[model samples]
Target: MKIYKKGSLYLTEGGEMRDDLINIYKDAPAIFETIREEIGKVVVGQKAVVEQILVGILAGGHILLESNPGLGKTLLVKTIASTTGLHFSRIQCTPDLMPADITGTTLIEEVEGSKHFRFEEGPIFANIVLADEINRASPRTQSAMLEAMQEKQVTVGKNTYRLEEPFFVLATQNPIEMEGTFPLPEAQLDRFLLKVFIDYPSPEEEYQIMERYTGHAEPKVERVITRRELLSLQQLVRDVPISDDLKRAAIKAVVSSRSWEGVEYGASPRASIGLILASKARALLSGRDYVDRADLEVMARPIFRHRIILTFDSERRGVTTDQVISEIMKAI
Candidate 1:
C-alpha cells in the first residue's frame, strides 16, 4: 500500500509494502477501530451493521435504516453519536409533524423592551440527527427535509441556515407497518447514500444480548474520538485518491442497477457518485490505501438497493430488490 501526503492511497503489486499512500491509510483505520470498539461496549451483535453505518459517516452521506421496531435502530444512532463524540439530536416523526418541527422556526421575543424575530434551531442543527420513524410523517412534513439532506442547509422563511459541518442524518423506518405510514417518495429516497436493512441477531448473539441486559445491567460506552478529530477524519476521507478506473466501475455498478431486467427505474447519477464516495470510505476502513473492485462490488447493494424501483412482474414473482441487485452485481 502506498500512502501519499495528499491522502491518496495506492496498492502495490506485491501487497506487502505501500509506496506513497501508506501514511494516509494508517491514520484512517485507527479512528474507525476506536469507534467500533467504543460502540461495541454498548451495542451487542450486528457488528456489520455498525461498520456499514460508520462507512456512511466516513463517506459524508445520510443513511436510511429499515427494520422492525425494537431492533435498536434509535439506539444505534445514539450509540454512534456517543462513541464518536458528536452532538446528537432526535426528531420523532408523526402524522402531525410539521416542517418547523425539524428545521427550526422563527419566534418573536422581547429583547430590552423591543420585540424582534429570532431563529431557533431545531433538532436538525446538530452534528448527528436521528429522524426516528421518518416514514410515519406526512409527505409535506417529509419534504421539508429535502433541502437539508441535499444541500446541507435548511431554508426557513427567507433566510437559509447552514447546517454544522460533519452533519449526518440516520433515519429509520418500520418495515412491518404500512397502514399508518406514508411511503417515502422516490426523489426523497435518492437522497440517502446507503439503505441498510437491520436484521435479527444470531442465536449466540441473542443469548449474549440477553445475558448482558439481565438484572438491570448497563453497557458501558466511552467516547473514542472528539468532534475536531471526526471533522478532520471526514476531511481526510474526501481527500483520499480514487483512480478513474475504480470511479468508472462504481458508476457502472450503479448504472447496471437501473438498466437491469425487471427494473422499473434504475439508480440516478447521484447514486453513482454516492457509490464512489462510499467505496472509498469502505476501503479506508479496511486499512487499504486504494479502492479495489471488491470494495465497489461489496458496497453496490447497500448503495443502490433503495434507489432502484422494481417492476410489477418482478414484484408479482416474489422478486426482491436485493435479489435483483445481486443479479446486477453478477452481471457487472
Candidate 2:
C-alpha cells in the first residue's frame, strides 16, 4: 500500500490500496482475541477496560486509569503484561517517592582503584510498568516519568539510556480519595494516549469474580503473542491508510474541543495527532481498512477526555469534559 503525503494529511489510492490495508487489519482481531482469552484466565470481568488497554498498546502509547479502589486496575495491567509475555514491573507511588526511585540512580563504585559512576535502572525500564496510585506521589517524582513516557528513554547524570521496545506504562489513580494526593499536571496528562474510566462490574461479572477467586485452583494464563509480534503490529498500525477526509475530521474534532463552550482549554495539536493514531488502532481492531468518521468518534472519548480542560462554570453546572466532547462530535 503506497501512502502519499498531501498537504498535512496522508491519503492512499482507493481500490487495491484499501484492500491491502483491510487485510492487515483483519489479522489483528485474531491476535487481539487470543490476548483477551489469556487475560480472561486471570481477570474475571471488565472486558471494556481490557480492550482499551490493548488499543493503547497497539497505538504505542501510555494509559491513565481512573477508578475506585479494588477495581482491579493493577490486576488488569499485570494481566496484560503476563498475557503479552512482557516483563512487568510495578511502582507504588507514595508521598515520599523521589525521582530517583522511579527512574534510575547514579552511584559511585570503585573499579580498578578508580571510582566510577554506575547507573542503576529503575522500574521504569521494564516492558510494562504499572504505576499504582500515581497521584499519591510528589510532583517532582511524577514529572520525572514524563520524559520516559514521551521519549522512551531516561537520562541520568548526562548519560542517556534507551528503553526496550513495546514499552507501556499503565498508571492508575484513585478518584475517591484526593486528600494529600497531588493531581497530575495537565502537561503530564497530555502525554497519555487514553484515560480509561473503569466502573463497577455487572452482577454477573461480580459473581464470576467471586467464583474465580474462591477456588484454590489458580487460573493459568498463556502468552498469546510475543514482544516481536507486538512490535510488528505497532508498525502495521502506523502504516494503516488514513484518508484525507477522516484526518481532517479528526483535526476538526480536536480543535472543536478547545473552542467548545464550557471548556477552559481546548485540545492541542498533540491531541489531534493522538486521535489519528488511536483511531487507526481502533479501526484495525474493528477490522477496517482505513480510519473513518466512526472510528474517530469511537476513539474521541478516551483520546480527548484528559486533554480537554473544563471551565469552573462547567464544573459548577456539573458539565463534564466528555459531555463537551460529545457535543463537539454532534456539531461536527
Candidate 3:
C-alpha cells in the first residue's frame, strides 16, 4: 500500500485495481440507485440521509443517527438490512438495560452429566445491529458498545468473539435537549463514521406516507443486492482515487476546526481519515472513478459535526456545529 501524508491525514492507495474491481465500479451506480429505490418503497424521502448511511456502510464504519421522534430512523436501518440481505438485530435501549443485554451473557449448561459454561450471544452478534434510542441507555451500557463499534468484536469474560463480516452498528438517538437523554462523550461519539441528521419530509411526501401506511396493504421491498456483492463493492469503494490537492483540502478543513471561532474543541485525526474515505464512497456511489471537490464539500459537515465541541458563548448564541464546520470549509 502506498501512503500520502499531510498534517495528520494519510491516504493509503489501493494498489493495482483488478478487472473485478473495474466491473464493480462500473456497476456501482446502478446498484446504488436500485438500493435507494428499494429503500424508498418503505421510506418516503430523506435521500441525503440514505446516501450518507450507504457511505458509512461502504466504508465499513459505524453510524450515529439523530432526529426527532417519528422520523423513521429505526425503519431506515431495518430497510437497509432487509434490502442488503444482512442479518439484522435490534436492541431497544433503556435506562435499566445492562452490559450483558447488549453483549451476551455466559450461562452454565450441563452436557454428558458435566457442567460447563456456555456463552449465549447477544444482539450484537448480528451483521447489522440497531441500537434504537441509544441515549436512553446508561453510560455503563453505552461503554459496552465501544469495543464492538471500534473493533467489531465482543469480549465476554476470558473469551473473545469475532463479529461476522460486514458488521455495522447503526445507532439512533433523539436530540440531546430531549428529556431522559444522556449525552454521549466525545470519545464514544468519535467512533461513529458519520453522524446523519434525518429531517422531516415535505407535505407531499408526508401525504404519500399516510397513503401507504393507512391502507390495509403494507409497503415492502425486495432485496436489491446480495451480501457477497455488497462486500465486493465495499472493497471497491476504497479503490476509488482521490487527488492530492483535494486530500490536502480535506485535511486543512478538519485541522482548521481546532482554532475556529466558535469551536471549543476540534475534530481529531480520525475525522480527517473519515472525510477522505466517505468522499471516496460518495464518488463511487455517483459512478465516478475519482473523488471531487463536491464530494469533499458535501461530506465535511457530517464527518465533523459530532466530533467538535462549541464554546458556551456559541451555544448561548444558538450556533450549531454545522455552522462552524461550514466556516472552516469556506476558509479552506
* Candidate closest to the true structure, highest lDDT: 3
Candidate 3 local lDDT, residue 253: 90
- What candidate 3 gets wrong by more than 4 Å, as runs, is 1-13, 16-20
For candidate 1, lDDT tens digit of each residue in 1-332? 34323345453443333342344345667767877888887688888799789889988999999998888899889989988778899999999999999999999999999999999999999999999999999999999999999899999999999998889989999988798999999999999999999999889888877887885868868888777666656655655567898786677777777678899999999888888788878877887767888877778888888989999999999999888877877776
Q: After superposition, how far is residue 78 of candidate 3 from its true place, in Å?
A: 0.4
Q: List the residue pairs that clash in candidate 3.
A: none
C-alpha lDDT of candidate 3 relative to the true structure: 0.89
Task: Output the lDDT of residue 38, model 3.
Answer: 94
Q: Which wins on lDDT, candidate 2 or candidate 3?
A: 3
The sequence of per-residue lDDT tens digits that candidate 3 reaches over residues 1-332 is 23355555544475555555555656778899899999999999899999999999999889999998899999999999999999999999998999999999999999999999999999999999999999999999999999998888899999999999899999999874567778889999999999999988999999999999999998899898878888888887777788899999988998899888888999999999999999989988887878999999999988999999999999999999988887888898
Candidate number with the higher TM-score (1 or 3)? 3
The 10-residue segment with the lowest total lDDT in model 3 = 1-10
Give all TM-scores, in the order shown: 0.91, 0.91, 0.94
Question: 12-129, model 2: which lDDT tens digit per residue?
Answer: 5532233334444456778787888889888877877787788899999999999999988987888788888999999999999999998889999999999998888999999999
Number of the candidate with higher TM-score, 1 or 2:
1
lDDT of each: 0.83, 0.85, 0.89
